[model samples]
Target: MTDKLKDKIEKFLAMCLKSKSEKEGDTSIKVDELTEEQHREIAEDAVAITNSLVELQRLLPVSRKLAELGYLLEVQGKITVKAGEAYDEAALNFFSDMYGGGIALSKRLH
Candidate 1:
């Protein structure tokens, strides 16, 4: 890792450690005292976790809408389970923006 990135990660770890120590009334943890391997491992894990959280946040809205659609379909008795599958393939096409437009255009061209 670049020195700048390592420095930032070290600073962030120190701040987090200080805050946690204050909350738990323990001041023994120090970022500067960590071995190089430990520090590198923590930094890598932190970045990976942050990326996963960001991806989940971005997908949350789409997932919510899909859930709502499923509920409405179930309530109306419009969807059925087949061989333990929760959703039908055709019903899911409704949520695709390109589905309707593409089908209509293809029908027109053919």
Candidate 2:
């Protein structure tokens, strides 16, 4: 990727992280009484993150790699007893092996 594209990717990833953090904070805030405006604000933030996630899925291979890793972690130990359960773990391991693990994958992609 060009340096400019790489910078854009990094900024996008930072936005993803920030959105996630904000969502977590919003969840906590939701316990308190919220006005309609506040509720709309929270909903809009969630929608923004969801839309960004969809865009990232299209734009970044690393996002897929990380998602596969998460799936693999969820299913790694139960492959033999349950093939369905193993799918996630196998996928995670496959991506990790394919890309030399998460850190390397992110660095190489960005």
Candidate 3:
């Protein structure tokens, strides 16, 4: 990685190392007090949270777009998920702007 990232990581590691105060100023953040089962559980929990974070990152944009479409449709006073301009024009335009055109219209016309 870059020197800036490396420096930041080194600084963080230094901070972590200095988080303990015991035995004549020897600073070591040890998990020796923690049981092996607890350590395994903590690692499993971390991995689960990391996986959830990855999925959330992947889904956030799609969820945001869906929320935007819902808001646009509701502002135009329609909440139904229909498939045509007959229900909500603003929602149609919101999606058409992304995909370049309406799929139904393209299928019917071309």
Candidate 4:
């Protein structure tokens, strides 16, 4: 897929896939394009920082969208608060798969 297309798909996934605030909804698509591993890989990289603070802000909204938002690190299976963490720290702990966190895909999928 082209870069533009990838970005669009990623954005759609984020919006439709739902979060704590976004309730479950119907989403139907014939996704034979990307393999399961590919999908996982893309998601793993979904919250990557581009060295842009504006982009970084998405993972750590200053208005405290992440206030009630707590990360449930997969490996540890514990909730980490986002209240007072720095932007980078919040982003890393909240969305870094390498460290057992990231918008929990399993929770989002279910």
Candidate 5:
């Protein structure tokens, strides 16, 4: 995909994620009331991200970077939740797979 298209897709995904995170807030406010067109756009963007990750997984170095990128994306998503914002699960899960189930574990002391 062209750079312009990729940028648009990324923005759409981010907006949808933000909308979801906002709904998780304690204030009990409704989401931003996105239009049907906006929802469709978000869905398309999610598909694009998933496809790109799949292709990137075929390359060793790129695959490694993809996993790290996934971790960063998940971290950003969690930060949005902590800030009382919303995030899309599709976007979160896409990265989760790349990062091997999404949570990093540390070894316990013996």
Candidate 6:
């Protein structure tokens, strides 16, 4: 999993584990409050992130989008290009393809 996706998962879990009232909410983990549709939506978002990362990795093989959003790393004093990270035509194309070959994925998420 990419760091970004891991972050999202962690955040979601934290939210789910939070209690509105330490008393009443202390009964048990109320994951049942989240409907099936809500769960499916979260799954969809995860899939989108995974697909985006896959394309990003393919566009820049030797890069590290898996750990960071933009791929600019120095190992042994060598630079690697992180594609689909810039606001250029190539990145735009990648985002478009990521969104079912249509619109661009949210810049903030990318």
Best by TM-score: 1
Highest-scoring model, lDDT: 1
lDDT of each: 0.71, 0.60, 0.61, 0.51, 0.59, 0.54
What is the TM-score of each predicted model, taking all chains together? 0.52, 0.29, 0.42, 0.21, 0.30, 0.32
Q: How large an RMSD does model 6 have?
A: 12.9
Taking the tens digit of each residue's C-alpha lDDT, what string does model 2 give over 7-76? 7655654554456559777433322344667546655776798899899788567656655666655567
lDDT tens digits by residue: candidate 4, 1-110 = 99999888767555434441245443443344446885676565554533455566665554354333333242255445455664445544555565555557667567
Predicted candidate 3 versus true structure: per-residue lDDT over 21-90, tens digit per residue: 3534875444555456755765576578779999999977767776677776777775555555342345
**Model 6 residue-pair collision total:** 0
The candidate 1 region of ten consecutive residues with least summed lDDT is 86-95
Candidate 1 structure, TM-score to reference:
0.52
Clashes of 1: 0
**Model 4 alpha-carbon miss at residue 32, Å:** 2.6
Ranking by TM-score: 1, 3, 6, 5, 2, 4
Q: Which 10-residue window in model 4 sums to the lowest lDDT?
A: 66-75
Estimate the TM-score for candidate 2. Answer: 0.29
> Each prediction's Cα RMSD?
8.7, 14.1, 11.0, 18.5, 18.5, 12.9
Q: List the residue pairs that clash in candidate 3.
A: none
Better of 1 and 3 by lDDT: 1
Q: Rank by lDDT, descending?
A: 1, 3, 2, 5, 6, 4
Which parts of model 5 have CA positions greater than 4 angstroms off? Answer: 1-15, 19-32, 61-110
Please provide, for model 6 over 1-110, each residue's C-alpha lDDT reduced to its tens digit, 9 standing for 90 to 100.
99998787767744644633354557455545666786677668768888999998787643334334322223322334455444343333443566644533465456
**Candidate 4 ranges beyond 4 A from true positions:** 1-31, 49-55, 58-110
